[model samples]
Target: MKVKLASSYGFCFGVKRAIKIAEGYEDSATMGPLIHNQNEIDRLKTDYNVGLYNNLTDVKPKDTIIIRTHGIPKNDLKDLRKKDAKVINATCPFVTTPQQIVKKMSQENYSILIFGDEAHPEVKGVKSYGEDQEDVHVILSISELDNINFKYDKIATVAQTTKKKETYLEIVNALILKNKEVRVFNTICDATFENQDAARELSKEVDVMVVIGGKNSSNTKQLHSICLENCQDSYLIENAKELDPNWFKNKNLCGITAGASTPDWIIQQVVDEIEKY
Candidate 1:
């Protein structure tokens, strides 16, 4: 049996930055959860007085606010400052671009639509980027757009940084058919695009694929979807301990891929466990 790993897999720059900041400030008592990864959150709990609050209303003044890579609401930040929390920004630069674009669209008086999963923290941050007058809509699929009847007027669309390549284009093409003035920005990060493309390619060559990342990880879940499109034997496991040997009983070749938030050491352990089988 042979094991192949995806070339474009592993942690991206943004995840690294967010995690690095969290680790650096772990000794501080004021930091919050750096990102949504449960493993990382557990590690952070040992160092900082981190609380997972949906809103900032629970944030105290002395707390050093450790912002996640997805960024936060402008009002929330302003409110945090007012409450005297020392803000430690950890937002990813790739995500910052869409926020800047939204500001421009707001000034141009265009109705905005964000293509992404509505429940995602990144999508929520993008939605909060809109100003008072600009109306931003979130679309998970093309079917949802039928409810909003708007003409070929000034309309702008931006994608969440980690959105799937195929789905983003499908929506863009669909919108182009309905409105003449529809503008789209494929804000999906370069790393995300490369990772997904590589994972999809690997799925075709391997009999089984083992994806390593937390379940809540957006990019990791997308990688699983890409593998499922090509190979049904794909398994998503957070770590080596979760991998069941039965899944690969008759497999000759296995492909291993990790999410942007996955650590290399953990990935190696997963690979080692499979090798022992």
Candidate 2:
């Protein structure tokens, strides 16, 4: 019945900073999903009544628009400002690096490829940075790289900040197969890499793995995937209440890991609940 938790299981610095900014911005609306964690988002809504708008076109002139940590494109900023909406830039500094690199790569006429979940908010923003020009494509996985038909003479790649290093490297190696001149920014955030590494290590030694985070959380899903790879006894849940005690039947050395967006309190609650059983 013993339980072990990964040291890197809680909110990463980037997610903490983004949430702090959101907490401070009272009476404002985020331009998109503030964080992947629904529990935190639900809390924010209950306390601050903060709103979310994917399209700023209908935003009230007096409302302030906060950009989520994942960030938005340059054109979106211009348009928001033109609409007389106050723009709060909550973009994680790590995410900004890839955006800057994409801009630089586009100017150099090198074929640009972004490696990450194409449907993710981070990847969507990265894509926007290159959408103005026609030289960019996004590859979410190593398998997607085969579809890219760009010339090998000039190529550049960047990863979403929350991607696992293994997946990122897999896609990078795929690109290398087709192009020798490929440039990579290694844009994956340090926090994400540490969290995944810790989870992977824990999964190897644990009898069962519990990944705690919102279902919408991309990084949490990745962590769960990593756990499943290392140990089949892996489950993803948003809260301790969602966990069924029967799943741990006759199991020991339970491993618990949370996503970057998960708050410490939720993690502790889950761990405490597991201990109670």
Candidate 3:
């Protein structure tokens, strides 16, 4: 099989910045998995002595704490600062933009609506910035809009950094139709747009598609979804070991794309493994 790589794939600006920041702070711990990629996190742990802390209670006073790229809840950050830990924020500027927007809008008394999965770390962090927690609502789809009862006449909305733009637009459209005053801030990362578009185009031309990234990665799953729409033989895998030789049987062309959190090393490993098949 001839192996093809997507025109745009691998680490985005935010992921790259986070990795660089973490590398400099060896022996420190990240509040959460710095980025979604486990392979890179493992590499950092082994090579740099960086540790992972899943909760605020795990953090110690004066400990070096590097914030995850996804950021933490507003109150969590405040608590961490109160502990006197050396807090280094690695949040992607793209994600921070929406958080700030939500903070400002909520303080101004505008109901905040976030278009994202409530369970996602990014969405959770953004939702916490609202002055009135009850006014802040998170929704995964247009259907959830029905459950929201905004107290304020004016509303402001933002999307998860890695969400599909088309889906966000649908929610925005619904809000505009029902609400008299709506403030929409485009929060989707530009790199996400490039990566998803590239994956969609490559999947259309290949016999099989391989998306490389972490299992917990929202953007990687989105890429897999896009690929599946174009090629049913699309597989989402974290590493080369997960690749099945049977998936590539008789396939003439294999296209590979990765989430923004993926590294070049992982992508190369997948490509090398595919070539062997």
- Pick by TM-score: which candidate is best? 3
lDDT of 1 by residue, 32-79 (tens): 345546666666666554545556777776777777888776667778
Candidates 2 and 3, the one with greater TM-score: 3
Superposed Cα deviation of residue 117, candidate 2 (Å): 1.9
Q: What is the C-alpha RMSD of each candidate to the true structure, in Å?
A: 2.3, 1.9, 0.8
CA lDDT of every candidate: 0.80, 0.84, 0.94
Model 3 RMSD in Å is 0.8
**All candidates' TM-scores?**
0.91, 0.92, 0.99
Instruction: Residues 181-214, candidate 3: write the lDDT tens digits.
Output: 9999999999999999999999999999999999
What are the clash counts of all predictions, listed in order?
1, 0, 0
Candidate 2 lDDT over 1-277, as tens digits, reads 6789997887888778988888898878988888888788778878887788878776878788889888887788888998888888889888888988888887777888888777887887887777335567877667776676774367888988877677778877777776768898888888888899999999999999999997888888989999999999899999988989888898977999999899988988898999887
Measured with C-alpha atoms, the lDDT of residue 120 in candidate 3 is 93
Question: Which of the numbered candidates is closest to the native, going by highest lDDT?
Answer: 3
Model 1, residue 176: C-alpha shift (Å): 2.6
> Candidate 2: global Cα-lDDT?
0.84
Residue pairs in collision within model 3: none
Query: Roughly what TM-score does model 3 have, to 2 decimal places?
Result: 0.99
